[model samples]
Target chain A: MTTMADRTDATTTVPTEKLTLARALTLGMRTALRHDPSVLLMGEDIGRLGGVFRVTDGLQAEFGPDRVVDTPLAESGIVGTAIGLAMRGYRPVCEIQFDGFVFPAFDQITTMLAKLHARSLGRITVPVVIRIPYGGGIGAVEHHSESPEVLFAHTAGLRVVSPATPADAYTMIQEAIASPDPVIFLEPKGRYWDKAEVALTPYGTPGAGLDKARVVRPGADLTVVAYGPTVHTALRAAEVAAEEGTSLEVIDLRTISPLDHDTVVESVRGTGRCVVVHEAAVSHGVGAEVAARVTEECFFELEAPVLRVGGYHTPYPPSRLEHHYLPSVDRLLDAVDRAMAV
Target chain B: MTQPDVLDTVQLLTPEGTRVADHRYDPRVAHLDPAALRELYADMVLTRRFDTEATALQRQGELGLFTPSLGQEGAQVGSAHALAPQDYVFPAYREHGVLHVRGLDLTDVLKQFRGVDHGGWDPAEHRVHLFTLVVGAHPLHAVGYAMGVQRDGDVATGDPNRDTAVIAYFGDGATSQGDVSEALTFAAVNQAPVVFFVQNNQWAISVPTSGQTRVPLVQRGVGFGIPSVQVDGNDPLACYAVTAEALDRARNGGGPTFIEAVTYRMGAHTTSDDPLRYRDAAEVAAWRAKDPIDRLRRYLADAGELPQQFLDDLDARAEELAVHVRDTVHAMTPPPAESMFDHVYATPHSLVDAERAWFRDYESALEDGSVR
Candidate 1:
């Protein structure tokens, strides 16, 4: 049995290591549990199975059943109970096994969890972090592949964020746990095994905040913005665009709700064009919100209209046809090509 | 499977106002002094007055709507008084008596119905949660809070003052909701210290209790492995005794207990509802004969505990409360328009701040005639 001390020694000694997004999330939960006694993990199959994606792998063994609870297969109960636990002054990190399964808990999440803090007039703080693995790419059945980030982001009280890389996943999960407001942490399932070097140490200062966009790749021709699983596709598209002398900047919108409008507007003004990409449905999706905002804010600076590349207005197809349904590198480049046409 | 007989309900005070012995629950009520009984009676009387006045206010177009607990006063008051101050309560919308017993001002309770605030009182201060309008949703919260109480080492402490339990109050209709079933499951599995108080008031808006479940609600808890009892809800003494025992058992780490307080809704589901369209007058007359307040009044009178002066003073007190509710409800004003954006999140978000600023500008623009 690896004791807490031994685990700490191992993490501290390994200053930086290449870890997958799933492993980084596990490390983040571990850090949260070690830092605060109030932190708890609850979900179906999250305890014994370490989650279907193994995002919470080995956490139950280390944290004990009390802290890492395996709940009954009821999404509403998991989230509703988490609200009550939050009211009792515990920071509960709830895992909604998959994105599509979140609908069962939607009433609890949107009505009670999202509205409780405000209804109490700040007397109560629902410090809950709801982690959902979202987006399509994995050849899985229905209900497993979906990008429902916009549903939470549109809600007033919730703070919605998605992390593409392992390093940001490691840091942002802890930040979401530490936040006083309820946060919807959309984990990119397709990127779960994609590895990158992550600093074991904490990022930024204590309470440095997590609602900001990051410029992953710099260019001057046009700004290509994406988040979560689609971020890598945008980066690859940017690379492909670079070879053709078309300088395409890539911006990873870490926070979806607040939009980090300043960073996005500045980038768009610099490039004079913009293209937004997401895996959710095109109409009223996060991409649409971004397109609307960019059009509103950087209307005068735009050489071309802000374009959007996203899933068609249809249900997430079966695994066999998901490739055709979800946004791809070629689709993003085609949008970029249209932007350059102006 | 055969359904449990409805007559198996536990009763201490008969509908005729006669006190009777309850073998299982009498011990819990043995400690209630004359003063406590009088206090319980006063709680019911004042709560009824408050509820009636709120309903009248709604009819007069002063408030948006009102849900009256006119007939279930005994159940709410008795169960609420049975709880200790440290205990937490998750109330469904029609818990006026419970809120009053928990020390919430009548005017504060009316704020939500008056369209002034969602919930005017702070739950942390009173240990009473805000009214959950969604039926059966709060039981899960109650169970979760009980689990937290358990985690805090607040149960099985042997000290009655330190140990805590949670009570979730929902109507008979809520039993059909999936959340309530899940709550029972969670409460049983965790062995959490909680009391599931189902006031089987025989009506869920327009639908009758028969439509909700074929078996008695008490039996529903038994299936979930929770010890359950059915009490004559009109008998405050019985309600008090059963709830006290259940809460005690829970505080002592005895796990969850379900108490189905058998009662009736003598009024419409809400001020907006019309009972005449669905039910007959004979049914209302039958329940009126078994009025909880009248039975209690007869008991106090027969026991020689009530005097003419005391009865008159109680009437005057009820009138005073009615006036207070009416005046305060009328005096209540809507909060500032910009205040709507406050408390949406614990910390400030640029989006909310921007929206608040835009609203302020829009309001100012309208005031100064900048645009139509």
Candidate 2:
């Protein structure tokens, strides 16, 4: 990377940019809005209030009220009407204000938005995008930080995507907007402010294949599959393992609906051991799915059982306890260590 | 503006073919034609027949569950019919009667409860919003859509033909939701052309209306600055007249008006719940006397619009619809298992895709490893 304030040198050509991941998201949204006429954003306090996190700052003024709508303080109203507006050919993007507040719209997403296409036998498609900032890290009060993506993943007829990097966030968001199916785009709030260089392009230009999983780090000793905020944590654990000469593999599963099994299976086959980590509770969490898939695809190749490290089956812990609740660099490497021992 | 709706509440022709006229509600012969009354009576009978049939099927294990609207038929059908072709309707889950009026097929409505589909109708094509499972949420959607329609210059605006209004139907328990109150406030302030239809069928699951509110629920409308009224929900004509006028004024730029249809729950909340635990038989019997269909049938027969043959044909027609619905439910093939992971988000997701693949594998293994 080229020289920058945060990391003066990492590579030759690419520059180490010093911008918060949240600002990158804001800029990416602004660019997407300016680039496409169909793109419109609506949510509570997202207009004049500039959103609770100010991620939507200056968007209403730039896009105007009609495009950047300040909807009534009703989550169900926001989603149900977005389905109506989507029918009218407006590419309406909705924000749930917070993760806990999204349940009111769950019926609309799981039942209406999800099944509209399948029930209509593919005649009607709901391209509406729902954005929820998820995962606990910040000291924000309860109800603001939750990982409800697992529930959405259980729903039929909906796609769930969470981006862990500013680079993926910039692209995946535009991809979500352009998708024909309803997409639940969960932003890893814990990683929102961390900086990275993001490659920007025209909105709706799908970069990562809609269903393919991405391998964040290539290794041989063990494969660690993780998503959302946990992906970064897994990568950090991989760094620790590298110092110990363990050569750990890391996969960032950006998509949750149609599993990108080819990439995941490929990585698992390369590495003899496997572990899946997530912020969602482990009991029937996304990790359970990944572990089962790895067992199915690479049973004989796996020298160890498919292990999972995740949050406890309880409410997301308080901020002071979140560090303990969340799968950390140490816990992940420990899971990796256990897998290697097997 | 401080008083109740000045319009009449019709109470004519009981089940025994007798007519009664009161000071406030003189039966509106002006609005009713011979054919209209007969059709109205037929609508009520057939919908109730369908409701009863669905409940029986649920009990027999033919369907998953049923939310019965046995007593609220008149309130739903009457108010739904009042809408112009352009006006939109937003309904709570127990709105079989309204869906029937809006021409949604029985097969589609049943698919929802059968767990075969999330919902089976397109809101845009039918000019109705989705059946909101979340209590009281649809009113906000109805009102917001009305605001949109108004912004599009589609309100009644004293030009009767050009006005468009929205009707939101929810139950008494749903009124406790903050969304319901917020919807009324927004509709009132923006003067959105919308009507709030609350079918106070009394019990919200185990909780009675008394537990929720001390005042008449209709009066709560005035607190929000929206005019309000309480009507005998079992009276078909009263429900029709009140809803029609409210929709009329809404279309004519008269902001929002709340109509509280005072009715009783003749059946349990759903197939799973036992109402006997909470309600007494005496209360159910008292309300049974004011049954909406019997009174409408009496009015029609007395007016010479309904014949004995009409009653027989109605019975045959109801049974025919029931049989047809039953066949559709049983015939519905379980949607493909992968169909579960297909529609969570509007866009394809890497995380969801991975999980779906994972579930698909485990499911396949559980069923038989050979199945793809």
Candidate 3:
């Protein structure tokens, strides 16, 4: 177990270790709980069952039932009670079992949790984090794989974020917990088991801030902006595009709301072309916002019009047809090629 | 469902202005002296005056809309008075009496209806939450706050001054919402110190109470493992006694209690609603006979507590309040358009700031004739 002293020491070179995104999330929650006495985890089956995805495995035993609560199977109740808990100065991290189940608690999240701080004129702050596993490619049944990040991102008074890698997953979760406002933390379900080397320490750093977008793979030809599950696809697409003589700069948008447009605009100006990709529907999605902002800021510098590649404007199709429904690496590459052609 | 039994409803004052007695609740009633009784009566009267003035304001186009708490004064005033200063209140939109009893400025309450502010008063200062427009949503918030009180060791403490209880106010229609049932379940599981006050005014817009539930609304709490009772909402003494007892049990480590205040909405649902289209005039007349204010006034007169001078003074005070509301509402100025972006987040956001700056520039450019 690493102590706070060792974790904060910049002089110490901590050994990097490989961990899956799920394990990293668990570690992040543990770190938050250790850091603040007000921090608590609330969800159905989060205790005895360790959550459906096992992202919260062993946390109940380690932190005790008081900290890791197994609430009744009601999404609205989970969020509503979390709001009350937050009002009493407790930082509650609530987990929705699946992306599709989030609708049951939408009223509590959007109406109550989102607006409380603003309605109270900042006197009352809802420091609650709602963790949702979203996006398709899991081969699960209906209602299991769906990306609804756009709904919350569009709503004011809410900060929506998603961590695409293990290192970011470890740091961003804690940052979300630390936020004084309510946060809708969307986790990419398909990338839960994806592993990468992560430094267990060095949080709250300038580069590790929750709202900053990182250029994971730098290039000069065209800029590709993506988040969550699509970030992996975009990175993979960039690798494949390199062999085909296209240098694609890939940007992982950590925060959906309060978008790091400075970084995106700078990258777009460098490349003079942009492509936004996501798993949500193409119509009125985060991709649309990114495309609009890029076009608005980099109008004169653009060699081509900003393009977007995303899921079709339809309900999440059956698992068998989800591969065709979700944005694939080939589809992303096609958009990149179109931008380059223009 | 069978009609609600007259005897099943708890009452200390009858519809005919007779004072009755309940062995269980009479002691609590006895604690209130003549001055306290007059004060409670004045609160109900003043609240009604405020409601009437606001309604007239809305009709005259001085305000946008109004939701009058006409016939439900007994339940709102009695229950609000029962709360200690430390106790928090989570109220639905039609809680004019509750707001008055909490000592909130009437002008502040009118500001929202006047289209000046969303909620004009600070909830923290008053220990009363903002008026929640979303039905059945605030009960969950109240229950959650009660859970926090439990965790903070505010309940079961021998010190009554420090022990806290939360009262959640909702309506008959709100009981049908899933969030209300979810609130009950959460409160029961946590054994939180909360009182679920349901004002069953017999209508959810055009839908009747029958459409909301087949059984009496009070029984909804029983299935959730909460002890509940039905009260004659027109009887102020009964409302006070029942709520006082419930709050006592909650602050003393007893779990949640649900109180169903049987009343009627004697006015339209709002300025926009026409209640006459759905309900008969005869039904309205029947509920008018059991008016909460008239019943309280009759009881005070019969008890010899309402002298001619006292009645005259109360009338004068009510008129004064109406004038104050009118003047304050008329004096309110619209907030700057840019103020909307101020409180969206506790911390600064780049987008909000940038948008605010852009709007400022746009306004200045239009003033300078640089752009339209």
Worst 10 residues of 1 chain A by lDDT: A1-10
Best by TM-score: 1
Encode model 3's per-residue lDDT on A227-275: one tens digit a residue: 9999999999999999999999999999998899999999999999999
List iRMS (one decimal) for every candidate.
0.8, 4.4, 1.0
**A169-277 in candidate 2: lDDT tens per residue?**
7767766776777888898988888887765554444467456678889898888888889888988888889999999888998887766777888888888788999
Q: What is the per-residue lDDT of model 3 for residues B1-372, given as tens digits with 9 covering 90 to 100?
A: 323222378998988878887788999889798889899999999999998999999988999888999999999999998999999999999988999999998778777788877777888888998876888898988988898898889998889899999999999999999999999999989889999999999999999999999988988888788888899987888999989988988999998988999999999999899998999999999999998888878887888889999889999999999999999888888888878887898777788899999999998999999997
TM-score of 2: 0.79
Give the DockQ-based CAPRI class for model 1: medium
**B301-362, model 1: which lDDT tens digit per residue?**
78888778877888999999999999999999999878889899987799999989999999
Candidate 2 DockQ vs. native: 0.21
Clash pairs for candidate 3: none
Top candidate, metric DockQ = 1
Candidate 3 ranges with C-alpha deviation above 4 Å: A1-16, A202-207, B1-7
Clashes of each: 0, 39, 0
Candidate 2 structure lDDT:
0.78
Local distance difference test scores for all models: 0.89, 0.78, 0.89
The TM-score measured for candidate 1 stands at 0.97
Models sorted by DockQ, best on top: 1, 3, 2
- Which candidate, 1 or 2, has the higher TM-score? 1
